[model samples]
Target: MDISRRDFFKVAGSTVIGAAAYSIAGGFGSALAQAPVVGSTQITNGIQSVGSKAKVYFTKHIDAAHLIKLYDLINEGIYGKVAIKLHTGEKNGPNIIPRDMAKAFWQHVPNSSIVETNTLYKGDRYTTEGHKETLKVNGWTFCPVDIMDEYGNVMLPVRGGRHFKEMSLGKNIVNYDAMVVLTHFKGHAMGGYGGSMKNIAIGCADAKIGKKMVHGVPLDKELDEAWDVVYKQDMLMETMAESAKATIDYFGKHIVFLNVMRRMSVDCDCAGTSAAEPTIPDIGILASTDILAIDQASVDLVYASPHNKDLVERIESRHGLHQLAAMHDLKMGNDKYELISID
Candidate 1:
C-alpha cells in the first residue's frame, strides 16, 4: 500500500510521542555532550556565550589535503557504512565543493559513499537516472554515489519539533550507521544561507513527499505548483530545523559536520551555472560534531569579513538566521561555540 504523508504521521504518532519524550529527557543534549572538546580559546568579536560551548575547528587553507586532515580530527564516532552527505550540485554547477576535494575526503573515510537525494524541482537531477548522469558530469565518479530515494521513502520520528511529528526520508538512509555532512556554505533563495542543516533537511528527504512536507505544500496539491504556493519564511525554516532534527536523532552520536566556505555565491548550487558570482573571499573549512556550532561559526566568520555585504543581505532578507534559532530551540546543538583555528 502506498502510504500518504498524513497516514504515515498517523501511524507513527505513538512512536513520535515516545521519541519526543526521550528528547525531553535530555537525549539530544546528552548525545551532543559526548563529543569531547579538543581545545578552547577566548571568545571574541561580540559573539555571545550561551551555556556550554561546542568546539568548531577551522583551517584557512582550502584544498583536498586540508579536508582530509580536518576530517580526521572529528572522525571518532563515524563508522560502518558511512554516508558522506553532500550537495553534488547541478550539472556543471560552478560554486560546489571541488570534486578533487570531495574525492580526497572520500578516500580518507573508511567504507564510505557519497549520498544525495533527488531535487524537488525539475532539473537534471530531478529523477534517479538523471541524477546519476549529473553525478558523472559533475565528476563524482570516483566513489559510490547513492541516490537514497531511488527505491522509496521511510518515516523518521521528529523529536522536539513544533512543525512536524515525523519526517519522510529516503528509505535507504537506514543502511548507514553514520553520516558525514559536507556542505558548501552559500546564499540560498529561501532559507537565507544553505548550511549543514539545509543540506540534510532538504537533501535527505524523499523528493516528492518529504519535500512537499518541508515546503508546507498540501500533500494533495500538485507537485508542479510548489513554487507558486505562499508560505511563511520562518515556518519553512522551522520545518527545515525539524527535518534536520529527525536525521540527527536517527543517527545519534554517529554524525559529524564540515562546511567549505569557498566559492560561496548569494545563490544555492541549485541555481546551477546561473548563480551570482561570489564577492566574499573564501573563508575556510570548518568541522565539528556539533551541527549548530559549525553553521553558527560559519555565519560568524562571514559576518566578521569585510566583503560580507551581499551574502549577509541575501541571508537576512530571507529570514535565514531563523534556521539557527529554530535548531537552538530544538536543542540540536549549541549556537555558542569556541572557534579553534588550525591555520
Candidate 2:
C-alpha cells in the first residue's frame, strides 16, 4: 500500500530497518521495500512540492519547437558548465534518443556538453574507446561527448536510507555546475523500467564499482563474479533509489530532467542488438524538475495505453512498479503528478 511521505519518514524514523532480501523470481517479496508514498506540500530538500501534484510539462509534437517549449518551462536555475547527461545508444541499438531531435536544445544551452559513462557489462560501451566509437556510429557528435568515468570515481552520501553510507559516482560529475538528465524512457531487462531515475543512478555512476554497488554486487567481487550475486531484484532497485537520491542531493536544485517517450520499446537502450521490437506506440516527450513525478507520470500513461499490452506485460512480469514504489519510499518525487500537455 502507498503511504504518505510524512508517514513514511516518520515510520522509518532514525532506525535503519533492513528488510529480508528476496530473489526477483520469487515475486516482489515484501512491499515494505517497495511500498508507495504520497507527496507533501511542505518543502523538502531534494524533493518536489507543488501541493500534491508536481507540474510535469508534456508535448506530443516531438518537434524542435515543442522540445524547446517543454524545456523552457523548467530551464531556469541551470548555470555555469552544464552537463547534458544522456545515453548514446549502443552499437546497433536503434531505440535511443536521436541527436538531431535534441540538436536545437543542445545549441540553446550555453557551454553544455553531452556526458555519459561506460557500461558495467562487456559490450561497445564497456570501455571509453569503444563507447566513443559507438557514439560516433550513432551520430551523437553534435556536441562533445564526455565519458564521465574516464577521469575516475567519487562517493556521494545517500541520506535517510537503509543502504550503504555513500554511493560511488563518476568523478567528472563534480566538474559540472549543473546537469540535464536526458532519458530515453523504456523497459529494462532489470529494474522493470528506465527513466530519469535510472539515467542518473546507473548512468552517472562509474562503470565498475559504482554500477556494481547499485546492482548490489559485493565490492570485493569482480564483474564476472558479481552478476549472479546482484540478481536480487528488489535490493538492487532499492539501491538504485538510494543512488539516484544521492545524485539529486549532490547536484541539489541545479539539475532538471527530460524524458523522450518515443520508440517505446520493452527493453533499455543498454540492451542494444538484443532489444525486442517496440509494440507500444510513441507517447511523446515529458519534462519536469521532479524526477519521481516525471517517471511516475510516464508509467501511468503506459498503464493507461490501449496499445501497451505487450509493454504492460513486460513491465508486470518483471515487477517493474517496485522501482517507482522504492523511489516513493525515498521521497524522490510525487507519484501523483498533474501532467500539463502543450499540444
Candidate 3:
C-alpha cells in the first residue's frame, strides 16, 4: 500500500469524503462521537448465535459454541476472505497463538487470511522471511507469507501516518474487505497492557516502523534523556491510540476487536518465555465491535486481578500513563463502550 505523496493526498481526500458520506448515511460517524452512547437494543440482533448461555467464551474455552457466536456476528458472506491479525511471538517466545489453537479459533471464520504482520525491531525480526520462518517452526501454518509480496512498502511513502513519517503496508491488507483482530491481551513492559490499540501498531507495523515506535525515546529529563520514562510511556499511549484511530478512519466498521485474556502475563508476548501464572486468575474472553470499550473493560479486569493489581498500578503511576486515559483523550471511542458480558 505504498502510494506517492500525491496519491496519498488523493486517498485522504476520497477517504474523508466517503467516510463522511458513510457517516451521514450509515451512522458510521456516530461511533467516533465524543459523547457516550449506549445501545439499549441489540445492534447485534441479526448477529447473535443460535445456542449457548455464554455470550463470550471463557479461559481456553474457545469451543464450537464460542466460534458460532463469534461467527454469527462477523460472517456476512458464506465464504469471504477475512484477515485475522495475529501476534506471532519472539524467537525465544512460547506465547505465539498455537497453530492448533489458531486453526480452531478460525474454524468458525474459515477461509481467513491468517494474516501475520511484520515486527518493528532490529533484534531478531528485521525481515518478513525471519517472521515467516519463526512462525512456521513454531507451528503457524494456515496462512503463510508471500516472499514476492512486500506488504510493508517501507521503500515508498505511506498514505496517512499521524506520527509515522511513512508506513509500508501490504496490498492484501489495504484491499482487505473485512478483518477480525485476534489479540492476546497482556501487559506490555512499555505500556500497562497490550490490547486492541497496540495490536494495530506493534502487530501491524513492519520491522522498521515497529522498532522506531518501540525505541523512539525514553522518558526522564533529570536522567539525562530529554524524554522521561513517563513521557516515553505517554508517547506510546499516544502513538498506539493515534495509530488505532488512523486505522479506523479508513476501515472502521470493517474491523472487530477480540481480546483473549488468558494467561494474563506481566510482560508482552514478545518477551518469549512461558508466561507467568496469572496474579488474579480467570481472565475471560471479551467480544466487542468497539475498540475503546473492550480495552477499558480488559484493563479493569487485570487491575482488579490480585497478581496484576500491583504491577498495573505501579506501571501506570511510574510512567504517568494509562491506556484508557490516552485513548479517551484521543476520542477513539466514547467512555460508554457498553459491555455485553458473557458468563
Candidate 4:
C-alpha cells in the first residue's frame, strides 16, 4: 500500500493514534484504521515524485530516442562537458548495451565521452589495454569505451570515486561540467538488480576502485579470522555498498539516470561467459534526477512481477535486497523519494 507524498504525514500520524487506540480499546476501530494504503509513498526524503516528470518511454514499437528524453530536463548551458558511463560487458558476457544504442545515444550529446574502467579481480579485465582488447574481440571495436572525436572525449583512469582522497583520474571525471549516466537495467547476482546506483557507482569507478567497491566487509565480524568464500561474499557486498556511496556522492546530484529494461539479464554484463534469460518481460525506460526514486520505482516494478519474485525472495532472505537496504544504511541514497510524473 502506497500513499502519495501529500498524504504521507496524515497517514503516519493517524497510524500512530490508531495503534494506541487499538491498545486501549481493541475492536472495529483497529480494522477501520488506515489499511496499509496501496501506493502510499513512504520514503520521506527531499525527493517527492510529485509535480516532477517521470518521462516513461519504451522500445516496444518504436525504438526510444533516449537522448531526446534527456533533452527534456536538460537546458542549454546547463552543462558543457558530459560523461556517458555504461557497461561494456565483462570478460565472457554479451548484452553490454548494443553498439547501435551507443552510436545513437553518444551521437546525440555534445562533448560526451564513453567511459569505463578496470576491475579488481585478477582477470583479463584488469587493465585498460586488456579491457580494450577484450572489447575488440567481443565485437566492440566499432564502439569503444574511450573514443574522442572533435565533439567529445572518452577516458579511463587508474583510481576513481570518493573512497580515495584523490583519484588518480581525479578531476577529469569530477571536473566535468555535466554528467549523464545510461544504464541497461538488469538483475545482479550481488545487489538483486543493478539499477542506476550500481550502474554509475561501480561502473564509473576505474578498475582499481571497482575492485574496492565490490570487496565489502565480512557479514560476520567473527569471520575476520575466516576469510573463505563466505567472507568473500560479505566483502563484495561491502564494496558494492561503499563504492555505491561514492557513485552517488559524485554523480547523484549532477547526473541523470536512464535505463533500458529491454532484454533484462539476471547477471550484469560483467558475467560475459554465462547467459541467463531475463526473468521478466521488458518494461521500457525511466529517467530521473533522483537516483533513489528511480531505483525504488525499478524495484517496485520488478517485485510486482510474479515471474521475478525469486529476486525479491532472495534479496529478503539473503541480504534484505527488497530495497537494497544497505544503500540507505551506507547513505548512498534512500528507498523513499518523491516521484513526479512528467508527460
Candidate 5:
C-alpha cells in the first residue's frame, strides 16, 4: 500500500523499536565483539561534538585524489583485507561514478578488493558469468572484483528488527576485515535514494535467497514476476534498514561510508541504459563512519540545491525519506550531523 507524504512523515517521526542487542553466532560473533562500538555520542577524530552530532566530511572535488583524501580522513578503523563495497553498475549504464576515479581510488587502498553480489532482477548481472562480463564492459578490471554470492549465501542476525529476525548475505562477506561502502548517491525505483544503506542492504545480499528476503518476494516466485507483487513502501525501507544493520553489526567500527553525489538521478544504477537522464546538478562527495550521517547529509544536500525539484519529487513520490527515519529509529547512526567541508 502507498502512504501519503504527510502520513509517511508522521510515521517516520514516531517512536519505534530501538537497536537490538543480538550477536552473530560462532567465530564471527567473536570478531564483532572486538570491533569498535558505534552509535555512541562520544566525539572522535573526523567527528565533532557539536551537540552529539556525527561528523560528515564533504568536498567539491570529485576526483581520485579528493576521493582518497576523503577516505583517509575516515580510514582509521579500516584495516586488514578491505572490501570496497560499491555498485559496479549495470553494463554501459550512464551516470555511474567514473571508472578512472574508482580505479585510482582502488589502487590507493592497500589490500582491497571490489565486492559485489548478483542482482535479484534478471539482467547482465544476474549470473556470475554475466556479472563478470558486465564488470569488464564497465571497466572494473583494474583490481580484483569479488562477486560475493557466486557460491552460496549466509545468514546474519537482524538485531531488534520488526521485519526480519535474520538477514541473508553473501557467505564470502566474512573474508573482509573491513568494508568501505562506496555508493553512487542517486534515485532508486524502490528505495527512493540509493545511498550507503541501499548499497549494502541489497548490494550485499545474494541473488537467490537474500534478495527475496529484502524484496519480500516468495522463493517460488519467478524472477520476472517479482516486480508485479505489491509491498508496502515503508516496510521495504525498514527492511532495507534492517539488512543494513546486519552488515553494520558484522563489521562494527571496521566499516566506513562514502557517497559520490555527482549524478543525482531518480533511477537506480541497476536501471542500466534504460535509466532516466539525471536532471540535478552534480554535488560533492561525502564521507562518514556513521551510515545514517552520510546518507542524511546526501539527502540534505539534494534538498538544499535549487535544481533539486525533479529529484525531490522523485524522492517524495516514492517516500524515500523513510530510509533515514528507519535508520534513526533503529539507532544505526545520528540523523543530526555536523557537515565538515574538507575542500
Candidate 6:
C-alpha cells in the first residue's frame, strides 16, 4: 500500500524518538567525550567535530519513512511563512529527489511553499515561463512552486567577501519568515560536490547578477567566458562560501538544512540532461541546523564509505573540499559535528 504523507509521519515520529533515545542511552554522548581526537577534531556517533562539532542527524532509509523522521529531529526554531528551498530538478532529469518524498515533507510543514530560482544557463529553467513548464514536467505540482527571481532581484549584503560586496537574490525571498534548505547531495562538474552550500549560493541566487557574482564574471559575460574568468578554483569556492554566508545571515536562526544523499551522481541537478549516473551507492538522508556541519558531515560520510573512490576523485580534482575550509574561515558553522544516527 502506498503510505500517505500523514501516515508516514505518524510512524516516523515514533521511530525517530525511539531511535534517538536508544542511541543516546547507549552511551553515544559519552562516546563523543571519550572519542580520541586528532588536534581538537573528533569523530563520534558518525560525527566529525571541529571544536565541539554541531549535531547532524542521519538515517539509512532513503524514502519518506526516514526523511519525515529526520525532519522532525532538526526542525527546531523554524516557524512563520516557511520557504522550502530545493531544486525541482530539470526536465527529464532522473536523479533529482522524488516528488513523493517532498510531498510527505510538505505535509509536516505548515504554510510552506517550495521555492527555487531560475537557472543561469540556457535550459528549461532559464526563464520564468520555461521554469514553470519544467516544474510541471518534473512532477513538482504537489505544492506551491515559487520561482523567486521571476519578479525581480534584491541586494543582499555580503559583509566579508573577497569578490563581491553584495549578492543579488530573488526579491521575494524576503517574503518567507523561515527557510528550509532541502538539498540533493551530489557531485558537480565545477564544484565537484553540491549540497547545502551550493544549493543556497547557486540555487538561491538570482540567475543574472547573483550567479555571475559567484562565478566571478560580469552579468553580460557569456557562459563560455564565465568559466574561463573564474578558473582560479579556490576563488570559486570562496565566492560560493561568501554567497552562502550572505543568505545564511539574511535568515539568521530561521533556517534548517536537509541533504538527501540518494542518486549519488558525479553531476549536480543543474547539469540536467548531461548529469552522470551514480558511481557511488546511495548513502542516506542527513539533517542539521548548522550548514557547515551538515556539509562537512556529508563529505566525511562519503569519504568513509568504501565506494567513494569515484566521487572522491571528482571532488579532489575540482578542489571542492576547499569550500569547506572557505566556509570555516567564514565561521559559518563548525566543520566538526557529532553524527547522531536516529536509525
- Highest TM-score model number: 1
lDDT of 6 by residue, 1-343 (tens): 1236224423332111112111111110100111121232244544443456677888888998789887777666678789999988889898999889999898889999999998878888988999999999989998999898787666665655555555677767777777899999999988989999999998888776677767766656756666667647887898898788767777777788999999878988877878888889889999888888899989988998878898999999999999999887777887767777777
Name the top lDDT candidate. Answer: 1
How many residue pairs clash in model 5?
0
Per-residue lDDT of candidate 3, residues 247-291 (tens digit):
554454566767777765667777776555446564666666667
Q: How much does candidate 6 score in TM-score? A: 0.85
Error of 1 at 125 (Å): 0.8
Error of 4 at 20 (Å): 50
Clashing pairs in 2: none
Structure candidate 1, residue pairs in collision? none
What lDDT would each prediction earn against the true structure? 0.84, 0.75, 0.53, 0.50, 0.81, 0.77
- Candidate 5, 1-343: lDDT as tens digits: 1125224433332212122212222211111221222343432334455566777888998898999998888888888889999999999999889999998988888999999999988899999999999999999999999998887776666766667767778867877778999999999988888999999999998777777777777776756786777357898898788888888887888899999998778999999999988889999899898898889989988988878888898888888999999888777888877787776
Clash count for each candidate, listed in order shown: 0, 0, 15, 31, 0, 6
Between candidates 2 and 4, the one scoring higher on TM-score is 2
Model 6 spans > 4 angstroms off: 1-51
Candidate 5 has an lDDT of: 0.81
Tell me how candidate 2 scores on lDDT.
Answer: 0.75
Model 5 lowest lDDT segment of ten: 27-36
lDDT (Cα, tens digit) per residue for candidate 2, span 1-343: 1125324433332211122121122112111111122322432223454455676888777666787787777777578888998888788788887777777779988999999999888889999989989988888878888887886676656766567556667767767777899889998888778889989989988876778777876656667776677757777778888778777776667788889888878899988878988988898899888888889888988887778987888777777888888887777767766677777
